[model samples]
Target: MIDQELTKIKSSTVLVTGGAGFIGSNLCENLLNNNISVVCLDNFSTGKLKNIQPFLNNSKFTLIEGDIRNLEDCHKACENVDYVLHEAALGSVPRSINDPITTNDVNVSGFLNMLVAARDAKVKRFVYAASSSTYGDHEALPKVEDVIGKPLSPYAITKYVNELYADIFQKTYGLDTIGLRYFNVFGKRQDPDGAYAAVIPLFVKQFLNHESPIINGDGSYSRDFTYIDNVIQMNILAITTTNEAALNTVYNVAYGDRTTLLELATLLKKHLVSLDESIANIEIKHRENRAGDIPHSLASIGKAKKLLKYNPQFNISDGIKEAVNWYSKNL
Candidate 1:
């Protein structure tokens, strides 16, 4: 069972891989908000320094430009780090489909490098960004940790591989580790212009510019879109948890609710319209579904609830509302 007040480690030193990306940057902010010392590492493959520019001068923070795929870089970043939050990866199924070699190099080889560095450096705990895509082709309504399906894409395979490697590390190397299989996470600082950008940010940007946002299918596919804050909470919990049962396992981190693409567009339009009424009439176009895209995804976070005392505070609508507000202010 999870303790209500998890054991708090002295945040004297912490390293976050991909700390300049959407979810990673949010985690960095929350840790800093708690007065924790943060060491951020990124190769700028997708992460931008501007995302974490506010923390540049903070005495508690240090930025290291490094690639996780390189063992030397990982070793340098892991030096004296108390906790390691691994979030570096080339995300998005379409992107992986377009370039499987790059995705494999970053998500697999890079992840392994980070794990080796954490182990060699004797870090307290390793917490990595897993994905709901690990649930893959399962037709299950609510995804659970124990049950899984065939991987549907290169991206999904890589995440599942992360969990597998983490488990192996625990058994073989006596390394403490935890994996959070995050659902579709979105919030402030999510880049809205990339070819592989997430749905919420991209749609918000398009709506802001009065451009038609394309829905991959007929707009009926659904997802359990989680918030970045919730993901941060899970990382904090995973790193802080002292429960032996929870230390070496993977948990679903999500809002436990599903929303369809059509419903998502509707909600985005409503939020954008409230901010700027001119966006109300923005159209959403539909096309053939993209390959490697899951039809529907919803996570069963019971394991997280029981093991990590995980509590998610945002659903899709609330998250969307917050994300829209951020984009409105930032973009």
Candidate 2:
């Protein structure tokens, strides 16, 4: 079904901003694999050159080394594009907290630039990478789309603002938009050597090196750790779904299951030890919880399933296994 939908748009071009980043690069690869034309725009601030190096030689792949903060760059990438997958942003809550101004400048101002570029280019759809952090202090067990609380961090505010702007763009300018609220996504190509690196990849790399993995706050914090493939499916569905009800709305792109930090470390160790038995002796440490960290995060993927026919193929365990294998070979 995904292939059939993509086949319909094979003749069309997709402009993926931040295409050198983890999720963006994966999207670019999947689109190119499907014989779809892809234009990748990246500034390499957080996105690495190695991530998209494989696609550099592909005839269907076009790389625009530029920043989205500049509207001209956005315009250049959107030229002749049929659809837009806006993945460019300064991710990480701690990074945003340290420098809210830069985060807002790139996430909010840059997002607006892409919206205008896509609108002016007359693209069929504008799908963007929203964040589950938008759930904020809502304290809901299963986060639904409509009910959201005050944003807990600067990153959350920027993501929620993206949704608001997308709604206004659709209502006022007649541009179709879809916002995908991604949960704790992790997989191959994800950077594990950074201060703002995600937990799964960070832990995987630590285990591989025989270093102790740290668990914050007694390891009770849980997340709906979705895999990259599931996120890719959500993006494809957002752009290709024929259902009118699915258009101009936000959907949670997650696995619909939660795993605590302790559980996650245990699982990673279990998977990694299979490759190297000595890793089993690596101890897990604990520390105080970080500020603005949510106690638990689990998404209600019912809207995505009902509207976009999203069927997530990998759960946390399966995703961890694949990610562990990749990190073992790559790291």
Best by TM-score: 2
Candidate 1: where is the Cα deviation over 4 Å? 1-7
Residue-by-residue lDDT tens digits, candidate 2, 61-102: 999999999999999999999999999999999999999999
In model 1, the clashing pairs are: none
So what's the TM-score on candidate 1? 0.97
lDDT for model 1, please.
0.89
* lDDT, candidate 1, 1-331, per-residue tens: 1123323665457799999998889888888877888999999989998999999999999999999999999999999898999999899999988899999999999999999999999998999999888888889889988889999999999999999999999889988999989898989999988678889899998998899999998999998899887888898888887798888888999999999999999999998898788888877899999999999999898999898888888878888888888899998
Q: Which regions in candidate 2 have their CA more than 4 angstroms from the true location?
A: none
Please, what is the TM-score per model? 0.97, 0.99
Model 2 gets an lDDT of 0.93
